[model samples]
Target: MITFNRVRSSILKAKDHRRQLLGIHETDVLRASIAEAPHFRALLSEIQAEAERARREPAPELSFTDFHLFAAQGTRIEYEKPYFERRGRLLALALEAWLHPEQKDLDALQNEIWMLCNEYSWALPAHLPYTLEGVASSRVTMPEVVDLFASETAHALAETLYLLEGRLNPWVVHRVREEIERRIFRPMFDTPNTFPWESSTNNWSAVCGGAVGMAALLLVDDRERLAGMTDRVIRAMGSFLEGYEDDGCCAEGVGYWNYGFGYYVYFAEMLYEFTNGKLNLLQGDKIRRIASFPAAVALTAPLYVNFSDCSETYVPNTGLVSRLHRRLGQPVPEMTAVPSLHADHCYRFPHTVRNLLWTDASLLHQPAAEGTFTFPDTAWIIDKHRLAGGLFAFAAKGGHNDEPHNHNDLGHFILHAAGETLLSDLGAGVYTRDYFREGRYTYLHNASEGHSVPLINGLPQAADREHEAAVLKQEVAPDSRLVYSLDLTGAYPKNSGLRSYIRTFEWSGQAEREEAHLRVNDSFTFAEAVNGVEEFFISLQRPILSPGSVTWRGQTGEVKLTYDADTFSAEAEVIESLDHGSHPLTVHRLRLRAGRVPGEASWSFLFTARAL
Candidate 1:
């Protein structure tokens, strides 16, 4: 319902209003305050250190050889490493120059900006489309194929120009504006649907739309033209919100919630400021629910509900969280520490700058409420309690296999005790061309084999919306025990002869001891006698296996699982792989097998976690 006329009418008539959005004109005041701010000292020091390093080192060269590597070799690391490094350097240089504005820093920042403007395309090669002809043959031109980073690059340059207009050389400022108009604005306005992300219900839509809209808000002067562009971005942002149901459960997990929603908030704030708070995009009940998602999913301070393609832990953007808390009066998880400027390899400009502008130290003092929360719309349940020993938590998901950053995992659960996620969700896998293509499920993290779920007749769960788990029961007892059950038959292939598969979980705290216990009962009924059934439980800690019990020792605690030795054989396997960061990762898989089971079979497992 956001139209061009609505957008145009909302804009303030004051010429200098845009410049005052984030107090961009008050650089001297910011620099003075930032130098003295205790919380920002570490951030300022890191930025200064990185700026010094960048001044000495040559900017990472992005050559044709590196650009073509993704197309030819099907690997992303080779090109992306240096590509992101250059941007990281760019971000450092810009921030330092803005804060200090010394002749040396200004010179370095100007050179960095010019070099970025000269690049053929702002988008990464991996993000570019490979048509039927091939990547080499595809006409991936600038402005025509605007991706997330392309739009972000435009926003960065626009902000830089706005921040250092008088100081920067006239030529550099002119070139930056021209490139933004050519690369982002014209393509976005002229040829709609040139990029699929415009209508995508994921991070791409928010990041691309938000970044583009922010740049236009900063730079565009013509209100009518700006309104048209803003309308498109508003609609794209709507689609991104649509991806989440009313429950505000982010299907892609917390990492992407940080990414996609972060951008949405970035643009929303800018729009609100531009319109003098007349148009507030962050006003609705759904947005408040979405804003509270990170706190709801956190197992502890850092560990989160890493259900889909997400890392086990991530440093939240404190500025974004603080702003949300201030605006919506929603509870955000307390951030023990702020992320370093170099935390993001991509070196996003908005996140870095806003961290300086919006982060409130007082917000960290508000304590978050702890208890059980269930999202029936998404089939996600989470329970956490602070026992005498430590924090104990459990999270389970029963949504369809086809989700944002989809993993073929249903009826998967995670158990946390003390500070460790004993039974862990093997978060995200490495990214290669094939990692997203047909070979996606071959990666352990994306496959059901990597999750804590049962295999029916030696077959893993199928991938699609149709192949989904059905929640049969969810209830809480007066004694604070939680009981949840799911029908997981639809998760398997029809050929697997899975007539019915029920998984029920019962979690309760021990009355006499500072410990927690979880009992999982799995009942299976096949159309015929099944060949075998194997239950796979994944953990980061090495597991010790006995005849009937398996134990995983953590840094501060241990989780021991007990099953019937007569019915199931237990064994453990060490898996070596790469994590989402492409770092070497090791996981232990505890497999409990029931051989040659009858048409109907049932198994139970009791897991006990105690502080060491």
Candidate 2:
């Protein structure tokens, strides 16, 4: 029952120690570079000027509502106040130190720097012990607090503090470090809680947590502590890699796929610098494919069939790709045709979408070939466009409901068609209050509706039969067209009598076109003969821009099938609006429920399409 107030108070009270611990004598690491490298000097000056402009502007007041809006949009707009202001100051001080290493009078700049850091520390009181209650109604537990506060805001602050050490109080750095370590790192490793950190199910825990750990190593000087921290980080990374089947698709949607993958790259870059390339993550074949995942999803028009909690507003992260290219010692490619946003400072590689798309052409042209497949816990895609193409992919389930940015879609799959995604999984939605974590929001993610499974008894598929239990059984097989299977019989209550649901996606790979037959079989044996079993449906949806058609063929049962392609266009219909100008490509939901209690029931659909 960690309250926001409690966390905030703890953070504030810890400030005194932070100031003392970070009080190291200043040393100008970048001093020689300023004079030796003109580009570095210019960049530093530019950063300082920007910081000055921010300082001159009046601080704007923002409410929790404003924060929610920015979070959802993935924009840091509200940072014009405290968070960004502090970051700007830190950048200025660091640049100033680089540009004027011998300056005897840095008093003014140092004062402003401390003021910003202290102000950030003060503001934590308002948002501490982060809780959904501030946004929702109920008081969440301590683990939830950790999840809420380990946000983009917190990450930004931690990064800024790490980057601008020495200019601010040593104690400030130590305090911020301790707060994050206790609230985020400790709980992540020591506790059984399943936010992003505990679940090795995906790469995000490794990436994001890895980045934080790198920051910690950068700021903390104790050799023993650093070794321990690095060991933990390596283990976490190992967990993420374990989730990577030789293929590369993350069970989490592409959006999370990007988030976790991006963090992996981020941490990898830091690890490269810290270890002088001795411990390179890019060396791994499975890990390297993660870099190209965005390209696979981008091959389809409008990018992906973001059926889960995904929106079209998300564009490719070209900057990340550019960074990867450099890290791997490749030439930076021309990228401008792809839709993208400007790269932020925190990102390791800051190229525009155009750059990545253009460079990724190499990946697309390599060849649509198939190769030896490895079945990790999940089936994922590594080189989706090569010999592996659609042949390589993974599927698995079992992430904590308490995981950061979790959806109730444990058994869902992301399918690639002829090197492009014909039927794909939707990623996450905007992080607004309305969309925060409500699993029942049909359009929010690849939950029950967004997936290829049947919903029995009209109840959402719970991971566990009991509210506190974990998922029943999630398994996959790569040898046959029966590529994967998931049995959620345990998700139901007791004596629901062998109530079992299984989904098998069989794929037939051909040069010109690929076929995917989705078979969902369910058996429910009630103690007493049940009455009217009415509501049921089979749904197959793709993003609007998908250049293929999906026809549903009924296999068994006497259920009426309806087609609502939401679009009037000959090609596809636009149904839901995700952003200002973007609409979710159309969704074709098929429903089949028991008209009356028949003894048992089953349903299936065969989805076939040609590569666009």
Candidate 3:
């Protein structure tokens, strides 16, 4: 275990104690580091073929016209997608050449880097110079933009220089270094107020700060300047921590947790390595609890709490989870060994590099965690069980409608059986300029109606911090069961006459048989009678709707939902959302509507999914 104390002692006892560097001190060491990795050489042919394909490709060019398009029209996919696609090729070829000199493609690497330097700005066209209203603004001084992609690009350039300094052209090297100073260092250290991301409390803070800090460590040799940068970074990281509640619940959902918090770990590891144990940011009660978040949300394998604009199935990042476990002793969430090297995204470069560099290969042998966990601060519950037939899991959340990356999904829940999503959350909608700038909540996934919650008076849930849920109580039993209740009065409009909505979930698993059951009881009270109340339970399978029950069958087996006929009526609609362009998915919105009536109502349902 690489504990803080051991690292500190090792640093003190070392002969030289020079700042640690990856494959930079010696070429042989670099070669060995790559050679020992099982993936390095095996991925060589794959990277080379990718390089050949990239060489044959036309270089992507972004003009002021592309920049102006987003400003004029809310269309980001046209320019941003191609822009990122181009970056993917550049990074892949560059890393390939540096990692293997025996089959190096120096010309390709240099060509890509030169083109990268020539781009108008590493920042996305949308992020170039814009007001909060999404209109393009004039930049008089150094651009104060610190976006996710731009920051990572800076670090990638700096780290590339650090590794292949002598091989690169002197003039090109000078240009890259000068650009880094002008674009990032000066704007960050000399005039930080010009940059807005430093104080951000979301993924922006961790990602932007981490990327800039990596560049500082790789390029800035002056201790005082480096110290100043680290100081500002510490401040920004505090804001990132503050973004989560005491429950360590990531309101951005686990996807951004993998994104925002992932960068937090990436940079934290880099700092620890550079400082030689003097600064171990991983040592803290909050950090440890924060590290345990994935375990709390993991339902069997890929399924998770897709609260906000997250996906129904979140792929596990094994390298990151392993590193977190080693550092904080958090259990490794269920994960498969998938290579993260060649993923094509701007935010992926720094992380992919670090994933290859920092991961502990031994953690791959660890088994997926099995248990039940709850976070009371955010009112999230996850229960995973290894039953007689297969895996039985369930997860849900009741938080504010106005969380970062939030959907108005208060009192939302998900049920999984045998690695199958029986009850689902549609996660995110397709990304468009309108998705962010226009009516975000107007979309089904962004609206309260998109989740497994009540559609009171045929109205969706409202947005903002004031709309939230109160966790009344919770219980996790040793008999393989969990129960929790939430009061969702503030999740809707006051005029909706929502006095209090108490939604309870009780999950129980059978040890001797291959069966798991959940009882959802919704007891609601209103100040005045309204049109009607419709309860929604979104599912991937087409539910057979009836008078007071619905059922769905899939690979996981049959899931039968039986409710009170006197209180509600059931209906199913096939809702198709095109948020993920090529992979436009569909869901069955099983609605249970109550007739317009009195001030109080009670809805009860028993959900059981059995494995055969």
- What is the C-alpha local distance difference test score of each model? 0.85, 0.43, 0.73
Model 3 C-alpha lDDT per residue in residues 483-560, reported as the tens digit of each score: 788888889887777777899888988776678899999887877765578888888899987766788877856678
For model 2, how many clashes?
A: 51
In model 1, the clashing pairs are none
Per residue, candidate 1 scores C-alpha lDDT tens digits across 188-232 of 787644568877999999999999999989998888778778888
- Report clash pairs, candidate 3: 430-579
Residue ranges of candidate 2 with Cα displaced over 4 Å: 1-127, 130-209, 216-249, 277-375, 379-406, 410-426, 430-447, 465-485, 491-498, 509-588, 610-612
| Ranked by TM-score, top first | 1, 3, 2
| Model 2 Cα lDDT, one tens digit per residue, 371-439 | 323334333322232222233222234333333344555445444444344334445543333454343
Candidate achieving the largest TM-score: 1
Total backbone clashes of candidate 3, pairs 3 or more residues apart or in separate chains = 1
For every model shown, the clashing-pair count is: 0, 51, 1
lDDT for 53 in candidate 2 is 57
